[model samples]
Target: MSTAVATATPTARPTSRRRRRIGSTEIVYLALVGILVVAGVLVAMGGGNLFSTANTAYMLTQTSLLGFVAIGQTFVILCRSLDLSVGYVVALCSIVGATTMAGDPSRVWLGVVAALAAAAGIGLVNGLVVTKLRVNAFIATLGVGLIVKGYLDTQFKGPAGDVPSSFQMFGYTRVGPVPISTIVMLVVAAVGIVLLTRTRQGYHMFAVGGNVDVARLSGIRADRTVIIAHVLCSTCAGIAGLLIAARFGTGNALVYSYGLDLDSIAAVVLGGTLLLGGRGSVAGTVGGVLILAVLDTVFNVLDVDPFFKDVLRGVVIIAAVALYARRQIDPASSRARFRSNRRRDPVRSGARPDPTTTDGGASA
Candidate 1:
């Protein structure tokens, strides 16, 4: 019994450690924290304050637009799909909102509704193409995006409709170090978190993404769930368009040139969501967005070229995805090995075989 107790001590410690192992989300945030520390030091060395009141507001403000799009991206990605059409949808929605508002404050809500409705409609089409017509999500969204872009190119040459000052408040208003846009973005993210963790639709999304055949066998409506996710994603992108219109005080036909579609996807991946799908969270996505915003802020402070910013972002995304993939693969392999070792050799796994059970001569 004493020998067994000693052996058990080693096994128990590993079990406890495994239970308390840091998850992908925690790792992401930890990386964010480390990045912030490094950024602060670098900025300070360059004769700037990273956490100044103005800079803090700027960072959060930067996060607002991307956060909205990334939050939306989180949903569809978790459902094993992507939306390349988001950039075009954003451009279309901005035009729709501004044109509908036509500079009337009373029309603000009207514009908002119009933009969201347009986005949801586009999302519906994308989903239908992918789920019903059996088009791959990537191709479906890209085709839709090209169609929307062609429409925009044929109709508009530059910024068109106007945004009212009242609506502009969303882009500029700040309370302390937090912008109202950031606050709104956070609220949307909270709703996403709830949808994922507390709602049936959310569970179905995970189940379907994890394995469509299994979900189907379990009586889940996989197509409906994917459609729902796409709708939610485009709606979020529409909200982001609204933010852009608010910030610029007009609808810019060329907003799609910002590469928001890829940026949002990168943010979603950086937040620890699997690229192929099935496991992730809104909170992690939010953290990922903040890291991008921080990098943006730091770049601006250092006067880096816009092209270089994109390059750096691409590198970061690649690195983050690689790291996250390793993290995902390693733990499962570790658990499998641990189980196999325990089954094959109990003593090696820190278990002492019972003498009475294994050998009658030893029992005597």
Candidate 2:
């Protein structure tokens, strides 16, 4: 028994270390921390004052806007769906909300309702098309986005209608140097974290994304999960549109400069959310959003060309996806690889393999 215990102790340490090393969330956390450090260094070298109160405020505000959209996208993607229509929904909602306000502070709530309703409606349509009609998500949302874009073009050629002062205040008001929008964003994210980490519905979403057949067999309503995710996604977009309109004090169908649709997806993906779904965290998504905002600010300060910024963004997205994919190793394959490597080690060459290693490694 003493010898058996001694043997087991050596095995446990390597197994624990191996598990820690391969853990997807752990890897993502480390990567995020490293990226933030690098970003800080770059910002400092670029002559950007990231630590200044004003710059910190600006960063949080910008991050807040993008963060909402990305938060929405995170849910949708976690359910193994995409929402290409979010950008157009943002544009359309901005127009509807702004136009409804028509400079009346009292009627701002009316615009808010209309905007959110429209966004939710769009989400429902996308969900129906994908789940009921058996349409591909990418195609369904893209078609919806195109329809929204066409409607936007016909409705207005440029910025139209005024945003109410009350709405503007909601967007711009600060609490001891922190923008109200940023505060709202933090609240939204906190709610999201709770929803995903602590709720039954959130678990079902992950189950559905992990495997639709398995989810159904387990009595989960896969389609309903998808629909709910899309609704939340579009609703978030609506909220973001409202904030954007308030920030600009006007409505423009072409308001988002970096293409909120793709940017949000990029942020979600960069934050360690699997594009294939079933994995991610709100905190990771927030980290990803901040990284992007930091890079955008630094590039602007360095006078980088707009075209180069686009290229760099594309490269970053691709790299992030690739790195994420690398960490998604199959347990069976990992165990097999470990055994094969063990066989090649000189000290372990003639040793009888521990039968428990495969199961333990795979579980890890």
Candidate 3:
């Protein structure tokens, strides 16, 4: 009889993993900080202060309205759908909310409920058109917007209805430089962050956005997710409508002319959410909103021409999208990350090598 033993070569552990480069979100904030610094210097050069009380207030006030809509835009974009009707939704809801309130404090709640209900209903229609009717999201939303606009154009000649002083507090009240509207917008953003990270619907949004076919294969109801996303998006637009009513004391039929539909989409894209969908964060969107706010402030302070403001904004948006396109997550990095995780979670992966295991046998 002879004994035979085999010694397996020990699997060497990776000594180090490549550090993750800064993510698109982190880079966005860094760019924002850079812009603030540069803008501050420019303003100071002109014998003006960028952080003046009035300037801060104005920047934040603008940010609040855009933030609300952008956050909602984030939801639908994450589900791979776009809502071109948000500007119109804001217009409609402002009219609905303000008209229902009719300058009566007691009717504020009723107005809010009515406005939100209307926005949600429109969202349902938009979703149905896309899902049930098999229409493209862009065309479906645009068509819905046109329908809403036609009604607005025919029925109202100018601003109508008014918000009472009590409701106006939502737009005017502030904690120091921060308006209550901005604070509420931040709260909404917090809620959005939680939804994306800790809820089933949030996960479904990602799954559906990643690939509708794959999502269905995995038992996710993609259409339902999109509808929910649009509803949430429209509800956010409704909240924005309330802000408009609060600030202006009435519903302005021309509010959509501010070009918010494109602005909100730009902010979403600026936040690093893929235009095609499936990847982004509310925090990032907030940062993007702030960036735009800063630019608006800077332009006002520098006395840049209104036409030039649009051009500059266009440049920034294009540059940002192009810059971040190179930084998207790649398969090589993903595999490396998996290996790194497996190494740290030895028991879970069971792939970690153990040098101590050996084989010994005796054969006759």
RMSD of each: 4.7, 7.3, 5.2
On residues 1-364, what C-alpha lDDT tens digit does candidate 1 reach at each position?
2233222223333433446668778988999999999999999999999999999999998899889999999999998999999999999999999999999999999999999999999999999999999999999999999999999999988887889999999989899999999999999999999999999999998998899889999999999999999999999999999998998888888989988999899899999998678899999999999999999999998889999998998898899999887876798879887897787787777888764454332211
lDDT of 2 by residue, 294-330 (tens): 6776676567899999899888778878877776766
Lowest-sum lDDT 10-residue window in model 2: 1-10
Q: Candidate 1's error at 288, in angstroms?
A: 0.8
Better of 1 and 2 by TM-score: 1
Local distance difference test, each candidate: 0.91, 0.84, 0.91
Give Cα distance to truth, residue 49, candidate 2, Å: 2.0
Q: In model 3, which regions exceed 4 Å deviation?
A: 1-14, 329-364
lDDT: the better of candidates 2 and 3: 3
Global fold similarity of model 2 (TM-score): 0.84
Candidate 1 vs candidate 3, TM-score winner? 1
Q: Per-candidate TM vs. native?
A: 0.90, 0.84, 0.88
TM-score of 1: 0.90
